[model samples]
Target: MSDARQYFDLPSPFAMKRGGSLQGARIAYETWGSLNAAQDNAVLILTGLSPSAHAASNAEDPSHGWWEGMLGPGKAIDTRRWFVICVNSLGSDKGSTCPASLDPATGETYRLNFPDLSLEDVANAAQALVKSLGIEQLACLIGCSMGGMSALGYMVLHPGGVRTHISVDTAPQAQPFAIAIRSLQREAIRLDPSWHGGQYGDQSYPDIGMSIARKLGVITYRSAMEWNGRFARIRLDPEQREEQPFGFEFQVESYLESHARRFVRTFDPNSYLYLSRASDWFDMAEYGNGNVMEGLQRIRVEQALVIGVSTDILFPLEQQEQIAEGLQAAGAKVEFVALDSPQGHDAFLVDIENYSRAIGGFLARI
Candidate 1:
């Protein structure tokens, strides 16, 4: 029961919070399984930065999805028992309202003209879509990384509306280091002569710029230990060095380069910009004036599951601990599952056994 839609209509101006004409930008999404008679079986799944609306099994490509490995009939998400919905972020490139979307005024891509968007705005758009679909309450709101930030926004703005929330590998507020990383990624895109301040789609989007940003992200997403084990001691001897046909490279470097190339091919530069900015600017307390505990204290969800990776410096265990402690103080039932894996922040994506067990257990409890 997998189905997808490329767009939906909303009879109103689609302007971003920072202010710009989104014109007629559309949102892409997919639904899994059937809604129960009460229509309360819907579970919203928000994707990390870089992923489109695609989330589960669909006829367009039945065998592929960003989260195909973890979501299915018998898997952790269990489409058999829940109606799952994944939507593209408003400023995202994947058929969503974004800079790349056509601007009615200019009849061209919004490009850099798209205004900045807050995490709250993205959440509001999702909420609007949900309402349009006639869903008043979500069984669960699950998100990872940037998506986690959006989930935080939802919890903050619409208390008691979501029954459960699963925040994976991120926090409500961006760390300084995270901000710096996003700044650099944004700069990388800007440096490309073709980027033209994110309007770079004439002779093809800024592939180089996007590739560079993705490479930087990969460095943070994966753990050093995992890299060491995967490509340790493998170096480019002179004979193997292919300066031209034979490139000069270490196996690890080769792996990273290949990964970067694929990422650029699949990703859109503007979407990257929008999502990254959304992630960096996401401090739930920013609107509430930097009071995180105050914000968390408002959440009335019965339960929450916080997932952390031991080696994830990006979203370190300390940050997750803070969240757990705050939630406990709020008298909410919350559990933290720290997975031991060398994959760092991305352990949630690669380390299957521990993740499967943890998720299955949680879903079972529900």
Candidate 2:
């Protein structure tokens, strides 16, 4: 765990909005391909909330990697062609600095003490990492969801850093519905008896809180159509799926339970809280005080592509259109496409053909 956390760029200055400056805030990341003699082969791909620095092949899980479908030799983000870099954002807990990491001041974990991180701060830290690699400009900046927000913020914040931007099912600001759902998920964690205000004692973990939080999150990450189609009131023999196992009569209950359990095992509760809060506080309008057009005008990228899914409840197709509209208004050559997929917001990750076609065409044009 310590070694994993060590793969970082620490003490990266960020004058936060919540108050005092964070001293040990770090960004965990990894790079793929090579930066050519001119360092112009650089392609920056920011990660969503859960993914890590392992974007392409590595010694472990070497059979391609995450985003493998889109990023390959002759594919869209071809690693055989361009240099790729992916980083774990500062507030992320997946081996990056977050509430789980120990605070240098007290030697105790930051836990709830980890300051609130905004999308702009994430973009700034990621920009610092990009600069460290000697990349003064990027061929492209592509991201999904929260990562998508960061990508747009990067384009807006730096103006001339990236030539092309690809945003997938993302928006400039988190919608109210998104915020409400995320806030409820965080509340689920806090309401747990064992949570103890983000501090579960050294003994027992906040199992109940974390489990509930994951369930809440899973409910939003997917679509109702998917749930109905997958579960369909069908039970596992005897007309009861969650029964004899201390019982759940509804198929939805069983499905949610399994997802919640899996998430509890794979994710840290504090990390969930931190990232959720960070997302809840996201707003593109804040950057421009009030004018979204002004915010959009700040970007200087040559071209842009925004992809959205029709059934996505988290970030609907309309939100994605708004992103494209914002870019087009900025005088950027923008294209908006709403991919037809029933998988909801996660369609960007699951529906490969449509995503690949859009991304490939867009990149090919560039």
- Alpha-carbon shift of residue 116 in model 2 (angstroms): 2.1
Candidate with top lDDT is: 1
C-alpha lDDT score of every prediction, in listed order: 0.77, 0.76
Span of ten consecutive residues with least summed lDDT in model 2 = 1-10
Residues 259-341 of candidate 2 have per-residue lDDT tens digits of 77876656667877877777777677766767665666677888898899988888888878878888888788998998778
Q: For model 1, where is the 10-residue window of minimal lDDT?
A: 15-24
> TM-score of every model?
0.93, 0.91
29: Cα error in model 2, Å: 1.6
Residue 357 lDDT, candidate 1, scale 0-100:
81
Which ranges in model 1 have alpha carbons more than 4 Å from their true place? 202-205, 236-240, 244-247
Residue 280 error for model 2, in Å?
1.6
Cα error, candidate 1, residue 30 (Å):
0.8
